[model samples]
Target: MSEKIKIVLAEDEPSLALIIKESLETRNFEVIVTEDGDQAYNAYISEKPELLVLDVMMPKKDGFTVAEQIRKQDKRIPIIFLTAKSQTQDVVDGFKHGGNDYLKKPFSMEELIVRIHALLNRVENNQGSDDGLTHIGGYIFDYAKQSLTYDGNTEVLTYREAEVLKHLYSTKNEMVTRSHILKEIWGDDDFFNGRSLDVFITKLRKKLDKDKNVQIINSRGYGYKLIC
Candidate 1:
């Protein structure tokens, strides 16, 4: 028999955590629940869960801090952040700290389940070339490893970042619609997701800034064009 997918869930609210745990367990997921960031990190180390669902506002260390700490040790693990913070900077900070996905408060359980499955599928499939590498301007992007190396310094990218950058690189110098990217990578072109896409684009631009020749330009009201 196939083993159940294990998840580490860090939520400070007891009632919400219980509800989430029960809901996930019913869907064949084995969940380890922790109330604080410190506990969450400890659980991650001991249980070695396949995925993590973290609440941003925790007592001990905040979800972003925990994610940053974990990323130092394991960059491959998928992390999903659940939080009430919906500001643009908040969302950007979550991704910058290594979160693969972010779900704001008052979200449905169905959406959470779908996101969890999507992340697992991506991890299992391991998309990319046979060599898992690509070159853009003066940098080397290793899609398989989810990293970008420039001038001998490598920067690790989150799963979502790699996915977005890969798509942009594949269609370099050509305009790709915002709707297309939102639909393809995010599963929908809703307002929130659109904002998230913008955040990712900003991140990619910063990462590729070392090579002035490489730029992701906005075509306002249309899409983006990655010039390399």
Candidate 2:
């Protein structure tokens, strides 16, 4: 039999933590549950789990802080934020701190499992395309390095940012709805996620602004069209 995929879960609520752990275990995942941020970081460092599911609120250290600390060392380990703070800025902050996906509180076990599966599949599929490269406007994007280079300059992008840009580039000149992007990237199309998608779009606009030929146009209440 293949080895079970390991997961490090940091959640302060005992009942919720227990439920998530039980659910993951039933799905054949090896879960290490921690109630505080400190223990969660320790578990991550020692156990080296394949994925991390973290709550934004925790004792000793918050999920954002832990994620920042982890990102300093490991950039590719998938991090998912589980929090009740669904505000636009909060979601932006979560992504800035290294979250690959966000799940608001009151989420269902099935939703969480589906997200886990989607993320794991994405990570696995990305491995085979490490050397793939794409051209967007005047910039050269290297998938393996997660970087964009233009005119002798290169900027390394965060994992989520790279994914968003790649998707936009793939469908350049076509309209992509906010809900479609949220579902494709974050696995949900909630209000907070809609706001978060806006944040990412703003960042991508800034990054691709140097190329006059590349434009990300907001369709106002509909979606965005990336023209290159």
Candidate 3:
């Protein structure tokens, strides 16, 4: 059976939200609608939707805060920001905050639908799993366990770490851009996440350094290359 596209839509404009909800439902998407950022965050945590459509201007919290919190817990969910602020800085700031795609107010429902499908498609491509396991250097990755065992001792990895390692292992010796890492491991790209990624890189380096044969090569502002 085909999986239903799960969506969390947070729009304070009730009429706009309803229009988007109906349009998505007509396309067979499973949607959870909310009117505030707090409710959006609740929907994200409780329902764990596949995709999120957030509005910047909302009561309780803003889309940026909601996205930031979500990034800390779940990194593999796509996010789209819908807002009326068309300023250059606002658009740049949205991407810097964790938006996969940005849409201004009064957007065509059809365009929004297209963007949704495209984001979901990209997510599907990145989530493609092969073999369910990968071995690098002296480490044998148990993707299912989200743990790395070296020298008979196992170290538990955070969700993002595991996903990042797995993808890196799969694409060993290739240049995996930071954007690719964010999209595949955290589902969005932003400033908060950009810093978190550095921390993850440090942790990963420490974890795999025990085995000299395994190296996570950093390409500066680029990404990582897992060498075995």
Candidate 4:
């Protein structure tokens, strides 16, 4: 029998937290719910869950802070930020602080389940090479570590960033359509996800800039090409 997937859910509201925990438990997931950011962080350290669902607003450290701390220890864990705020900057900040996905609050259980499955499947299927390292131009992309090293300087990447880079590297020199990447990584090719993809591409360019020969070029109406 397969082991049950474990998840750490950090939400402050007692009613909402209980509902989420019960819903996930019904689906056979091992859910560990924490009421605040500090407890959430501690739960994460002890539980070592497969995924994390963090509410953006909480007592003590907030979801972003918890995510930041966790990223320092484990770069590849999938983190989904839950927020009531729909501000563009808030969304951007979530991604900036190591979030792989975002789910606005007042969400449906089905939607949450789908996001959880998409993240887990992506991580499971993309655990590249035994050593978890790939070479591109003069840089080394460490898949497991979620980092890129150039000239001995390593730039640690967020989980989503590593996944995006890995996808580009797999089909280097070929035109990979934006829709394909969005569907493959984000599980959707909608406008919001498209914008998020653009953000990740921009971040990748800066990290890979140390090597002059590497570039991620856009194809106007089509998609992007990784020119290495």
Best by TM-score: 4
Lowest lDDT 10-residue stretch of candidate 1: 123-132
Q: Candidate 1: which stretches are off by over 4 Å? A: 127-131, 144-147, 151-160, 206-213
Flag regions of model 3 displaced more than 4 Å: 128-228
lDDT (10s digit) by residue, model 4, range 141-201: 9878878888888988877788889889988999999999988877778777788788889
* lDDT accuracy of residue 221 in candidate 1: 76
Clash pairs, candidate 4, are: none
Reference-based lDDT, each prediction: 0.88, 0.87, 0.79, 0.88
RMSD of each: 2.6, 2.2, 6.1, 1.9
TM accuracy, model 4: 0.91
The list of candidate 2 runs beyond 4 A from truth reads none
What TM-score does structure 2 among the candidates reach? 0.88
- Against the true structure, candidate 3 reaches a TM-score of 0.59
* Residue pairs clashing, model 2: none
Worst ten in a row by lDDT for model 4: 123-132
Q: lDDT of candidate 2 vs native? A: 0.87
Instruction: Select the stronger candidate by lDDT from 1 and 2.
Output: 1
